[model samples]
Target: MQRRYVVVIVALLIVAGAGGLLVTGVCRVRELAARMNCMSHLKQWAFALHNSADTFPVERNEKQVSAFLSGTIPNADLPPEQRLSWLVSALPYMEQSHVFLQIDSTRGAGDPRNQRPIENRFEHLICPSSGEYDRSSRTWKSAGPLTHYVGVAGVGADAAALPLGHPKAGVFGYDRRTAIPNDIPDGTSNTLLLIETSQNPGHWAFGGPATVRGLVPESAPYLGDDRPFGGWHGNHTVWSSKKSHYCIVALADGAVHSLTNATAPEILEALATVAGKESLPANW
Candidate 1:
């Protein structure tokens, strides 16, 4: 009887160990799949921005572009009337032409017609790793729909203060000038274009100029401010406080790269600028 009991105990322990390994493997696979999907989404966004620039060249200053696209110039002086986000302008290239057509260019993002598209949830814009979507907890706070990705505004002490027409060296600007390939003197592959965040300030269609200031460290404390550069996963301090260890970013060349929480803030800032003429790190 004693021998039989020992044998059964050993068998159960072996089964338990095998189950633990299997679960670990499955979780790893799922995490990898999520990362890939997120990268794919970033690629699509980069391509779409390129397509938009190709079709609508940035011929004039930021004010001119804003006037042409949104029928008004966005600036700190007139905060309430400022509308038209970069995402809305790129909708046609994103396979959202029908939705784009519905948007009234003459009206601001708050307009009823423009709000229609913003209110809808877009799965492609949501990061699967971020887990289930919750409209109630959007970063924009009832402004419109929420997004997990945002553009790098620029790298400087006053990055956030720059008006729409005069954006810093980043790929995207507020309803400002559209950046063509020629604008990025630092090489497209080396410049950062878009980044993922658990919390985003503007809706995909609202065109409120969603951007991240590269001044803060990638792993900086959140402080509940939605304007800084950071993510929900990894070392970022936002929403649920869970750590995912890495943040996803897309370069101007439409290439996706994974940035760990420990990546140097200087490297991130360098990548955020368009004409800063900075060199990438050895590993980057």
Candidate 2:
């Protein structure tokens, strides 16, 4: 009887161990699926951006091209509030043409005509890893719908402070039209375009709040804090995996890469510029 009892106990222990391992495997698979899904979302945006550029090529005369999609035209006597963003301009290519048509580009994102589309959530823009949608936070309050991704505005101490229409090294400048292939002197493959961030203003319709203006080091802790560049993955602050600190970024070439927090800051800065003339390091 004693031998039988011991045998039964051993079998139960083995079964429990196997069950734990199975659960762990399943969880890891799910996490990987979410990451892939996020990558797919970035890919879609890249495709739409390239298509938009093709449809509306930039004029040879830089002055003639609309700078940031701000609702107001440069040198025009329009109020600052009349600004719009690249996301709004690229709507037609994203298959959101109906929403795009509803927006009056001449008016600001706050215009009532843009309310419906601005508030509507785009599932593709949300990261599955971001968890349940909670709008109670300050980032989401009155910010319209939330977005997991944002554009790399430029490389500077404060690119966001620059006046609208000023030249930005990054692809999405203020009040600017879509960047063409020729604009990216660093090669489309090297230029950073968009990034997955949790610190967005949650307003996909506007551009001012959807851009990362400066080069925040990848090693910077993902404090999951409220900072604009902070991570939003649960209690973890950075947008990285448990095994490593990393984030997903899309290049102008339409390729998505998993960048680790250990990535060289100089490389990150160089990637944010269009004509900085900087070369990627050998290791990169």
Candidate 3:
């Protein structure tokens, strides 16, 4: 009986060890899959932007009718013909043309008539990684419009915050350097375009943080690590890697790159600018 008991104990221990390894493997894959999904979203948006850029010099009537929003202009003072974000405009390119048509471009996105598109839960665009959400409500959507990614408006809160005569040096925002893909003097692969974040991502159809965001450095404590513990994830703190130490960003070339949280602020600045001409660190 003693020998039999010893054998059973050893068998149980082996099974537990195997189970632990299997669980660890599954968790690692889950994180990797989430990261891939995040990257895929960035690529889809970037390709749409590229297609939009290809067909520029659009007619004023076309812009107003199609709700084809522009991010290069600063709408706060001299707003565009339509106060829509380019995300709405690029819907057609992303194969989501139906959602684009639902919006009544005759008025602002907040117009009562445009509620369907504005409040829509574009599941494909939502980040599978992190955000404050309630899965227990038997709901799989955000209360309002949500976007996990935003256009990089150079290295500030937005393009308007840059110094006078300074280029927006980004693909989107008030004074963007790359209105067309060719405008990126620093090479498309070397520039930052759309980046993923769990910060206070404003409305999807409306303007503001919903569309363009500035690439600020000095992210000593990326909120992703502490946010799951109930800290405020607001104040424009960028969070791409949920419960992680890295962030995912897409370049003008439609390539997604994983950046470690420890990446230098200057390196980030270099990538954000269109013509900074700053060299990256070795092996970066």
Which pairs clash (backbone N, Cα, C closer than 3 Å) in model 1?
Answer: 62-165, 84-207, 85-207, 234-244, 234-245
lDDT-better candidate, 1 vs 3: 3
lDDT of 3 at 264: 62
Best by TM-score: 2
Q: To one decimal, what is the Cα RMSD in angstroms of model 3 from the true structure?
A: 6.9
Candidate 2: residue 49 Cα off by (Å): 0.8
Worst 10 residues of 3 by lDDT: 228-237
Summarize candidate 2's per-residue lDDT along 90-149 as a digit string, tens digits: 678788888888777777767787677677667677776776343344242333476778
TM-scores, each model vs. reference: 0.75, 0.76, 0.75
RMSD of each: 6.3, 5.7, 6.9
- The segments of candidate 1 whose C-alpha lies over 4 angstroms from its true place after superposition are 1-6, 59-82, 133-144, 160-168, 200-202, 207-244
**What tens digits encode model 3's per-residue C-alpha lDDT throughout 194-279?**
77776666676766666677664444233244421112221122222234355778888878887766566677777777767788
Clashing residue pairs, backbone N/CA/C < 3 A, model 3: none
TM-score of 1: 0.75
lDDT (Cα atoms) of all candidates against the true structure: 0.62, 0.62, 0.62
Off by over 4 Å in 2: 1-12, 61-82, 132-144, 160-168, 177-179, 216-242
